[model samples]
Target: MAHTQKLEMLERDDYLRFRLPEALKERFKLYCYLKGITMSDTVREMIEEVLKNEDLEKLLQEKLLQEKQRENSRDETDD
Candidate 1:
């Protein structure tokens, strides 16, 4: 007799849930299945990639400074 792989049904207690549109969720599920990957692995890799994006951080900081400058200008106008 050959050995069979047992399917694991227990969810990870440490896992987090993210909400997505139904169509997009289905597409992502199928994509991961075809790529022989779990959703967790794909999301983890994407998170790591975004966290490593220095340009994104710089852009966000620039936007934050612009917002603060605008707020200061508004306060000056009101004074």
Candidate 2:
């Protein structure tokens, strides 16, 4: 088995802390353990996924607009 290095502790100025309900915290801890990832990493991945989805949505909208413009141009040329 490969040895794991200890994660660096967060400094007071380097991180923000939030309180979760006790029940939620317990559930989150269990979920994190089952997934074999730190809670922080799970949260970070979730946030990244959300941001990526938003960017994808914007790109899809732009492509749809371009397709509409092309169709309009074709219609004008045919008329």
- On TM-score, the leading prediction is 1
Candidate 2 lDDT tens digits, 1-79: 3233223332221455899999999999999999899988888889779887787878899999999999999999999
Q: Mind sharing the TM-score for model 1?
A: 0.62
- In angstroms, give how far residue 65 of model 2 lies from its true place: 21
Whole-model lDDT per candidate: 0.85, 0.83
Task: Point out the worst 10-residue segment of candidate 1 by lDDT.
Answer: 1-10
Q: Write the per-residue lDDT of candidate 1 for residues 1-79, one digit (tens) a residue.
A: 3233222334333667878999999999999999999998999899889888768878999999999999999999999
Weakest 10 consecutive residues, lDDT, candidate 2?
A: 4-13
Output the lDDT of residue 46, model 1. 96
Off by over 4 Å in 1: 1-15, 55-60
| Residue-pair clash count for candidate 1 | 0
